[model samples]
Target chain A: MVQPEKARSKIRIYMDILQAVQDDGMAKPTRVLQKANLSHERLTRYLGELVQKNLVKENQDEPGVRYYTMTEQGIRFLQELRKAESFVSGFGFEF
Target chain B: MPFPFLYLDTSFYFLSGIVAFLVSFYAFRYTRLIENSALRFLSIGFTVLGVGLLAEAFIDTLSFFIPSTSSYLLLHRLIIREAAATYSFLQVLAYFVILMGYLLSRRGPASAASSNGSMNRPPTIGFLASATSVVLASRLGELGVLIALAREIIIISSALSMAFLVAIIYLDSTGYLKHRNKQAILVLVGFVLILASQAISFSLGIVAARALGFSEILDFIGTAVQFAAFLSLLLFLIWRGKIGSTGKSAQ
Candidate 1:
């Protein structure tokens, strides 16, 4: 029997988003949507939360053009999240 | 740790404690990174069990080094027995905690996520609960031993704890089956070996009745199997966490 794919966990999503932003140094929403494979609404909401958490910063210095860049905290968070992911999954968890 | 009952092999217990410590460390260290209460409980369970094994190991070492000609032999032996009762208590408690983790995790991921900040006080509470039980059980266990009933009770309780663990591991294996995970298969086999060791020891009566030294040989085999089980899990955890990971598989 074919098993249904497990949904991406919230932490996984966060990791992907952080990685997407970090890869380009700074990223637009569309780029993040493409890289992270998230819907526009989810990317906006998650990015907003990440920004509020100080993991990410959204810049809108130029009118109507915004970019998301990873904070030092965000980079650290991603690295730790990756490690944590590896840690739990190694023990046969869903992660 | 195998319930050798009378055997005080300090080195074996000490090494078992170290292996348990490493496994518990792996489970405990990542709790801050994830909102999984199951992980937290697994951490707590292993931590309690590891501490119990290490403490028992120390007490056993103390008992082992003193000469039989020493005047304090009887008193030290009493201390060691009492310590074994405590160790047994902690072993059962550890299994209970791990079982509770499995039970709670069955409630699904949402509940685990909701439990994020609510768990800060649990370790303290757990410590307080167990500390009180340790005092009562350790002292009362001495009296129980004088009456020759404590060992029986310990065996029964240990059996129940083993039952709980068997059920949990059975469930865990089913999950592993679903995933077809080879690493999990290694873990499953390891657990099976440990359980089989217990089964062998528990039948020591029947085995001993059939032959004299055969039971002792079986005892040695059981201990070896238990040690191998611990070593296998420890090595798997190290490999999975370090060199074997590609970081994409979990995601």
Candidate 2:
């Protein structure tokens, strides 16, 4: 049976990004984009928003090489969203 | 004892209660996961529902085991009546709490912490309901008058709780439409069925019931319908939990 794909929520997208970063240790943007299953344009926009929100921090190891790690706020946000998602989804609710 | 049980039976209420508890258990787990105190109202309601039905079953079972000999028949009836009243009061309370929880959930997280305050707790109502039950249980010689008053109390409380159920069903309908959730639809159906059952019982509460002379019959029908409703919920919740979501995945 083919299940139709549902549109991912913004929070889901954000969490996917955070999760990718969390899994990668210090996440490269390329890897985060792939793991989060987002297009380059969308990833750039979301990552920028995330960094601005202080949920993710950007670091330059050397000159132009950028890596991201989840800020404490980002980790907490992801955890809370995960909890809310599981709970509300069980009831077929819009998280 | 024989008359009431003959109509309502013990198993229906007891079994329905177990279903309510299962639903409540699910809610409780979510509350812990989210660390939200507001959701506790929803869980608490289901727990009370389970307890009330189970208690009714326990009381009925206790009465059944007692000697129904002619000498003890009066005492038996008294006990049965009181137990039924107690169960009714609990039903009223369970519905009330569930309604409150549903409303609070809609209001969202801001209300959650503040709701923990004593003001939200209906301690007086609980005290009055439980106190009435205790009064009935003591088997004081004033059985006739006290039982009549208890019946009125049950009727009024049941009416109030049904109002609560109405509000919940209304909110649920709007919510269900937006979510398109399968299990939620099942729960909504269950609520409607229970409400129908309440209507049947409401008929029994009216003076017309004695004139109709089918209190036992109406009571039985109501219990059976309620039992079926709860059973449906229990079965579906378990079944759906395995299959997982319908792919809606909103909020």
Candidate 3:
């Protein structure tokens, strides 16, 4: 059973992964897992959560291969993050 | 016709070296006053490069004063080329390291960990490209190959960095970014000029090699472009000092 705080952390990770994909274009699960530094065990579960939330979509053009793409919601979330970053940086808070 | 001695004058190198040293000194001093760790690291890096250039200048002067001294001439020739190449490589590495420090300082350790995955990717790619170029140029016995490879690295890195700086400046200038960080703009302009100089010098090198069969004048011009880059860095340091003092007063 995942704790509440851990669940929130996972969501944040999902958001970050989504943002990375959006900025860098489509990535495979293996690539995303490496970049996000998530274990394969954890990535499957987290990616499931993201797909359910419609923040990411996964597809496989061929068998035995999977690619992840950010959804509209993911893009919106990244924009919000950028705005927050700008807001904090403007105050010389250094994020 | 022989190229003018002014093209490789020791006095020119000495003047540029002194200016670079002074700028690095000021950068270090200002960083201490402002208590910015990133700037401090940058200052240290610049100081190293400045000292290297100064030594190169002294070696060149020695060679000029006694051209017939085979030992001095050999030492001078060896030092000038190796020092310049090593310093140029280090300068690129220093920029990447300083940029990493800046990002880490701005974003806390936790944020650094989070951002590291993304941020590290580009530099890693660039390093690979640079290393590959070096190896290939060495194996192929072609200075042009090396120059081309380095040019690609410098161009891509500088262009990306310039874009980021421009965006920051645009935001600040338009009053969207509330903080008045003109230092970024100044540094950006310096980077642009440095990039332009490198591009021009590299192009000239290729042209000279093809047309004039490797003239020393071409070599001097290449080095001159690097000296100009150091001057730009010095000017930015001065600008940074003024900005820091003003910010202090405002506080």
Query: Each model: TM-score of chain B?
Result: 0.73, 0.82, 0.54
Best-to-worst DockQ order: 1, 2, 3
Q: Which one wins by lDDT: 1 or 2?
A: 2
DockQ scores of the candidates: 0.28, 0.13, 0.04
- The residue-by-residue lDDT of candidate 2 on A36-69, one tens digit each, is 9999999999999999999999999799899999
Best by lDDT: 2
What does candidate 2's lDDT look like per residue over B91-125, in tens digits?
A: 78778777766676565444553456122434345
Query: In model 1 chain B, which range of ten residues has the least summed lDDT?
Result: B144-153
Residue-level error in angstroms, candidate 1, position B8: 9.9
| lDDT, candidate 1, B114-179, per-residue tens | 564223333344345445544665687653343233234345545765787697687667657655
- What is the two-chain DockQ of model 1? 0.28
Q: Report iRMS values in order.
A: 3.4, 6.1, 12.3
Angstrom error of the Cα, residue B154, model 2: value is 1.9
Candidate 3 lDDT over residue span A1-95, tens digit each: 96342122333466457755765678888788877778899888888888898878888899998888888876665554443333223223232
The better-scoring model by DockQ among 1 and 3 is 1
| Docking band of candidate 3 | incorrect
Candidates in order have lDDT scores of: 0.65, 0.69, 0.51
